[model samples]
Target: MNWQQAQKDFEHFLLIERGLAKNSVQNYSLDISKLINHLSTNEIRVSPTKITGEILQHFIYEVAKILNARSQSRIISGLKSFFNYLIFEGYRDDNPMELIESPKTGRKLPDTLSLNEIDDLIAAVDLSTNEGERNRAIIETLYGCGLRVSEVIDLNISDLYFQEGFIKITGKGDKERFVPIGEITQNYITQYLENSRNRVSVKKLASDVVFLNRRGNKLTRAMIFTIVKNLALTANLNKNISPHTFRHSFATHLLENGADLRAIQQMLGHESITTTEIYMHVDKSHLREVIKDFHPRSNY
Candidate 1:
């Protein structure tokens, strides 16, 4: 089959059989497209089933010259998954990326905000306007629930179980998890819905959506980023902050406050404890406190 057909089938598998999010599938497709573009540009004649490791290596080398280590690593990883999928479908006998190695980019720690900084950020939200109330609720839900930006945007009014103190989040691959919502977050949401959201003429498509734009439509991811950026500027936060910073802060703060790692994993809807363990490195003092308070040898 041609490279186009191969990539199409691979994308279908990623989206349908693998249940990957659209963004993830698009990334995988883009990786394959880069390879396809390289072959066309260089006038190389090889189908996906017949492509050799040498060609892939040359492509990766070209990529390394243009991209950083992290980006090159991601493309390599993405290509590896595509070839593996071809093998799984009996289109190829051997994987091309088996000998390839990713560059050693050490553990990149997530940036977190201290409690005082978080308070200041939230305080920066202007309460004089209806949209400000919605923005405040958006920020609160993000930090309070440890939700990914995507989850916050996809949240619906039906997901809020305020009486049970939980908000249902639809995370990556459409996996659903109920994370506990604190009273403060619940109150903020309640106020937004009752006062601001109730006043807006919501679009039918976005009627059930929890967060809406000025047009009463669902808020876009870019809008969320803009909101966070403006808030950071207003708060005079020196750190490069995003909506994700709040999520990192949520996990780090919980871990530092003696919350169980497994429990934090559940709350964050992380598929693995290893993913949650990154927060352990965010605060070394928390580890010291754990050892001092709980280690049997601490009595000495």
Candidate 2:
């Protein structure tokens, strides 16, 4: 098969068989496209099935000259997955990336917003406008539920079980989890819906969507980033912040407040406790306290 056909089929496999989210599929596709670009620019003729480890090494070497260790490692990892998929589909017998090694990039900690900083950012919104109320709800839900930005955008009115004090979130890989919603978050969302959302002329089939742009369509991920960036500027905050920052803060605050690590994992919809363990490094005191309260030898 041709390169384009191979790319398309791989994406289909990732989406259907692997159950990866759209963004993940796109990232994988992008990695393949980079290889295609490398081959084209060098006037080298090769097919995906015919590409050897040597050629991939050459491409990665070229990539390393321009990309950081983190980026190079990511592309290498992506290409490894791509070739593995080909092997799984009977397109090849051996894995090309088996001998390849990824760079040792140490654990990158997530940035978090302090509670006062979060409040200031929320206060920066222009409340006179209808969009302000919607933005407030957006920020609150993000921080309160520890939701990924995508989760917040794809949220629907039907997903909210306000009475039950929980909201259903469709996370990465289309996995669904019900996260508890606090009274503050529920109240802000309800206020937005009653005062602001009721006025929107929502587009067809977007009626059930909880967040809408000024054009009455579901908000895009870029829009969420812009909202956060603009708010950061207005608040005069020196730190880089994003919707994910709220999620990190949510987890951090919960840990600092003596919430269980497993409970925080459940609230964040993380599939693995290891993923949630990163927060443990953010507060050494919490770790010490855990040992203090639970370790049998600590009683002495």
Candidate 2 C-alpha lDDT tens digits along 82-161? 88888898888887877888878889998988899999998999999879999999999999999999999999999999
Q: What is the lDDT of candidate 1?
A: 0.92
Q: Per-model C-alpha lDDT, please? A: 0.92, 0.92
Q: Candidate 2: how large is its RMSD?
A: 1.5
| lDDT agreement of model 2 with the native | 0.92
What's each prediction's TM-score?
Answer: 0.95, 0.95
Q: Highest TM-score among the candidates is held by which one? A: 2
What are the RMSD figures for all models against the true structure?
1.6, 1.5
TM value for model 2: 0.95
| Model 1 CA deviation exceeding 4 Å by range | none
In candidate 1, the residue pairs with backbone N, CA or C atoms under 3 Å apart (3 or more residues apart, or in different chains) clash, namely none
